[model samples]
Target: MRFNIRITVSLKEGMLDPEARAIQGALKNLGFETTALSTSRLFHISLEALDREQAETLGLQMCERLLANPIIHRYSVEVLQ
Candidate 1:
């Protein structure tokens, strides 16, 4: 079976996101009011798997192995068939 997965990786709470902050600052300068902002990376992957559970597990393994840094990053995985 083939499965499609979406993985989102982001900095953990209390971690500073320079890009988000810079963008927010720019927005403020442009008269856009923003109280908070953050950034994340989204990855779309398609692979072969036996089931949804297996696909989700593979997605998480990808995150743990290379996509996200355990100490500073967190990730979410969704299996889209």
Candidate 2:
């Protein structure tokens, strides 16, 4: 079976996001007000799997092995159709 997955990676809480901060600053300069800002990365993956559970497991393994750093990054995996 073919599975589609969406993975979102982001910095852990208390981690500084320079890019988000910079963008928020820019927004402020443009007369926009923001209370907080954060950033994340989205990965869309297509692969073959035996079942939805297997697909989700693969997605998590991908995050653990390569996609995200356990110490500084957190990630979520969602299996789509």
Candidate 3:
């Protein structure tokens, strides 16, 4: 079966996001009011697996092994049909 997956990776709370900060600063300079900003990496991947369970398992493993840093980054995995 083929599956579509969305993996989102972002810094955990209390972790500084330099890119977000810079973007917020730029927005403010452009006369946009923003109280807070956060950024994340979103990956849309397509792959084939035997079943949904296996697909989910592989997705988790991928996140743990390479998609995210457990120490400072939080990630979410979604399997899209």
Which is the leading candidate under TM-score?
A: 2
RMSD of 1: 0.9
Tell me, what's the RMSD of every candidate?
0.9, 0.8, 0.9
Which residue pairs show collisions in model 1? Answer: none
Q: Which ten contiguous residues of candidate 3 have the minimum total lDDT?
A: 51-60
The residue ranges of model 1 lying beyond 4 angstroms of the native Cα positions read none
Q: How well does candidate 3 match the true structure, expressed as C-alpha RMSD?
A: 0.9
- By the TM-score metric, which is better: model 1 or model 2? 2
- Against the hidden true structure, what lDDT does model 1 obtain? 0.96
Model 2 over residues 1-81: C-alpha lDDT tens digits?
999999999999999889999999999999999999999999999999999999999999999999999999999999998
lDDT of 3 by residue, 1-81 (tens): 999888899999999888899999999999999998999999898999888777788888898999899999998888897
C-alpha local distance difference test of each model = 0.96, 0.97, 0.90
Enumerate residue pairs that collide in model 3: none
